[model samples]
Target: MKFDSVIMGGGLAGLVAGISLQQAGKSTAIVSMGQNSLHFFSGSFESMTEPPQRVADLFKDAGIGLHYRQGVRLMPLGTFRESAMSLEDIELFPSEKFARRVLIVNFQGYHDFFSSFLAEGLEKKGMRCRIRLINIPDIDPTHQGPGEMRSVQIARTMDRIWEKVVQEIRLLLKDEDAVILPQVFGLQDISVPGRIRQALPAKVVFVGTMPPSVPGVRTQMLLKKRYQLLGGTYLMGDEAIKAHVHEGVVHSVVTRNLDSHYLEASNFILATGGLFSKGLVSNPFQLYEPVFGLDVEFAEDRNTWYNPAFKEDQPYMGYGVKADDTLHAIIDGKPLENLYAIGSILGATHPELGSGAGLAINSALVAVDQILSEK
Candidate 1:
């Protein structure tokens, strides 16, 4: 049977495409290594805090187009609302409304000001807020995991600290029943693939603003488990060795350190992000492609893309497929007939906007609708 779609990369962008397409009555398969940058940073879902017009103008200045309507109100600091309708009404927010006490944990002292500031404003509205400093290093992938900062000990200490934090919050609410909401990293075992037949703790949901690497790894493990349970397959640790494409179409994918696998798909989506996430980075020699032999539009000089100043955010970090208004990958200046590209893998069209995560998921949602509509 031909698959409805095959998405590469399992992060928010890939998962969004997979989940959305599957829900739309399509069989979708997502291929990924299971690690996502979303866990390394604060997981904040952003809607334009400004008005729609102003938001449009702001994104316009940064070169991103507003494909859908802007959201009116904000969700919690770390959650993503599926659509504008859910965000327009504050009453629809899933989190409890007006909790008296809150916990703020900063392992590296660099919690998102956007979320932190909003939490402070909530405190002024008579919510008692407590901020704790975990003193972990700043967020960086290379310096991740419990071993880096002895985060294992830190995670162990949280159970006791959380008790105190909750007690203080209860007092502030003027009731003993008030409980502390922890902002520190906590552990939960999650189920992952291969061991899917039996329930296992594969994913680790991070409870804090900036989760340490251990939690991030655990999160991926959980997703791998869940993805497999949902009938998805993954080729991990092994890199894509070759793509057998003929006449502008992908035929099959072969991986080195492994064996050959044939895939027949009616449609395909490339969610393999850019250099940072290894979507485009497939080998030690550093060749960038979608693993399916897709033609990529890129800078003449690779150095011209990345921001040189270590302190500055990489101005050239956003690079991938150059898509037309339909979000289809444009190869050799032409859109692939049945292929779509979403997420950070899409090129510099929206670089400075920092809207990649939300836009990627939202755009894929839009693309899935468009794809199904065409069928």
Candidate 2:
């Protein structure tokens, strides 16, 4: 089946692209493989207003323009905001006051408040809150029940632990939730799965990271049910293979679910995320571009990308793929048109001040408007 736009990767960025396109009356499909990164998130998206000192220096060194601020208010992708967003297609922005001020829940480390408590807060504020989580294991990965941590061992051993985290974050971003705050180290940008062409006419498949999450299993189930009701398409289970790109245009995506399956689409969005999301990086040696042979602009040295010690908790870890102000994919001093990249894939700035996702949305809003205007 042909789609007006084919989105590769189904993490938060991909989901937003799909939903926005569908709402725009465009035939859109999401090609995904393996687990999504939204599952293990805190469901609070932050548009970093402040960088952690050293990170600010790195952005300065990189010559990137970023502003540190309090949490900006969030609106849908089409709504107008004072500083952050414009009256563009699907205008949206994340709120800093809402994201940072709220009580957070960390299952692995233990914070405070679960879904029920947050629900109560939303009620008290008279603002509806969306409760969605995705860092949970599925029947295919777990044979044991929820109580057994061993049941999640498959995910832990298979690099699925982070995928679960991203899936939850993705859902929160898409569902108009409070905000998505994932504890995962970073994001990944994998290829679009080959499952978009396989979706049944009346069915919606969710291509997200699967594997059980800590105390988030119930939420994942509910999200799956609701996504189908919304007519989504997904390609979960296993990693996505390389994408089919010609002259800077992605035509099809191949995945690793059953040896190999090919899926095709028209226009595509690369939302596999950054190095951590596996949407852009391929190897630990710091190779980039997991799908379609897209060029990834990374630091000159891997050590420059991260602090020598993991304990440093440096925000410089957020880096990959450089683009110009137009948000076009750039490589070898040329911009690739018909190809718009967003989210963690951008190398212009780090998450130090926490504007990584916010900048992504801003860039996406910019790109979407350009696309719509051209239409």
Top candidate by lDDT: 1
Angstrom error of the Cα, residue 165, model 2: value is 26
Error of 1 at 37 (Å): 1.6
Tens-place lDDT per residue, model 1, 47-136, is 323334533432343222233443322233533344332111122223333345555434442333234664655565565655544332
Candidate 2 Cα lDDT to native: 0.45
RMSD of each: 11.1, 15.5
Model 1, residue 35: C-alpha shift (Å): 1.3
- lDDT of candidate 2 at residue 22, scale 0 to 100: 56
Worst 10 residues of 2 by lDDT: 188-197
User: Which regions in candidate 2 have their CA more than 4 angstroms from the true location?
Assistant: 48-230, 238-240, 257-262, 282-286, 309-316, 347-356
Q: How many backbone clashes does candidate 2 have?
A: 78
List candidate 1 stretches off by more than 4 Å. Answer: 46-161, 164-182, 185-239, 256-258, 282-287, 293-295, 301-303, 306-310, 350-354
lDDT (CA) for every model shown? 0.49, 0.45
- TM-score of candidate 2 versus the correct structure, residues matched by position: 0.52
